[model samples]
Target: MTSDKTELNDAELSRYSRQILLSDVDYDGQLTLTQSHAVIFGLGGLGSPAALYLASAGVGKLTLVDFDQVDDSNLQRQVIHREANIGQDKVASAKTNLQALNHHIEISTVATKLTEAELADLVAMADVVLDCTDNFESRFALNRQCRRHGVPLVSGAAIRWEGQLTTYDFRQAETPCYQCLYKEEQGQELTCSQNGVLAPVVGMVGSMQAIEAIKVLLTLPTLMGKLMIMDAHTMQFRTLNLPKDPDCKTCRD
Candidate 1:
């Protein structure tokens, strides 16, 4: 028996029957996901898995922004890029994986990195932003754009089995911006190159990142205004309920 609660037709049903079975997405939730646009930055260790799941879960449009190319070292954590795709652009490699996961969604890729101006322009065009970049420069730049545009952001980071996930919604008073947690001068203190992250851990964190992004777009309950950290060694989870810093240059703006 078909219910009027779903937006997917017979084809989509045949493709995502399992998901549709869940009461959460009987029909309307699935349609919301299939109609929203999510912009992901970096497309590396963390962004790779996030983009993959976002596309698979039927996020209407996936915009990938990256300026790097695939490398043999990237295969250790960049699940979306294969050994055979070593020399190709990371954005292109990501698109291939995203399409293979779900051909129904529109995959938009920017093989070039988004400059300050470019990032602002793209943020304006997207409903949500995912800060998956490894470098602080890009992360800060993206965070600034998210603030100026008042866009919801899901930021995730992973390194050597240590990972963090947080959501920012300036629309809500007292929400902490990325700057509140990681000050600018700290820089790329923990990069995959130096810290050496586990491949699966990156996948785990990135997958969660995607889940958070989906929740935000779906207007579903999520870890908004909270910082969640995970450690693989002790298998511990910590929730830090911190208030927005009044001096935060990004959010306080």
Candidate 2:
């Protein structure tokens, strides 16, 4: 396997040789993963596992954005950090772990919440964006950024063993944007913090979210324009096809 700079060492090549075995992601795709950049907003439960996998997969460049810090409560779901990192910044802790996973890649950390200023620029630079935030405000911000930049976003959410997955890139004709399904019509969403969430449930969803994100970045088939629902309680998976909304303020393009 070719390396970004130095050739992949025996262990390095053997470690990822399985992923490299796939035809779509052969040496070329591995190179693409190593040379590509992705931004993961919100380093909470979902972001934790997703970011870890992306980093371990040798995704050349990774930008982790989160404004929070590690807390005892986060340990149940946020496996990226341990109890020793309780007081440390989430981005800092995650960066350490990610780099340890693969030092060959570059890790970027933004210890701030998603803001309007310069959000579009980051989205434009990322090959794919992962939205793992818990609140509607951050989620909406990411949605608008994806729409504005025409970057594909694989969003995942898990609360209490139930999760929903969706992919959207209005750049494609007749594809639905996030707001098409959720908008000012709803009063608000029931967040996991307010309700509750299962530990492994977030990992299950977050891992799948990473899979979709990698696919989007590698230009492979993804779950675009479809919503996947996982009933962890019953271990059942269902797909809800999304239809384009002609009047969707964000996806009408």
TM-score of 2: 0.93
Candidate 2 per-residue lDDT over residues 30-137, each given as its tens digit: 767887788999888999999999988888788888889999999999989988889999999999888788887888889975558778877888888999988887
Lowest-scoring 10 consecutive residues by lDDT in candidate 1?
Answer: 1-10
- How high is the lDDT of residue 67 in model 2? 85
* Candidate 2 weakest lDDT stretch, 10 residues: 1-10
Error of 1 at 165 (Å): 0.6
Residues 72-184, candidate 1: write the lDDT tens digits: 98888888888988999999988987788888888888987557888788898887899899878877888888888888889988889888889887456666888888889
- State every prediction's TM-score relative to the real structure: 0.93, 0.93
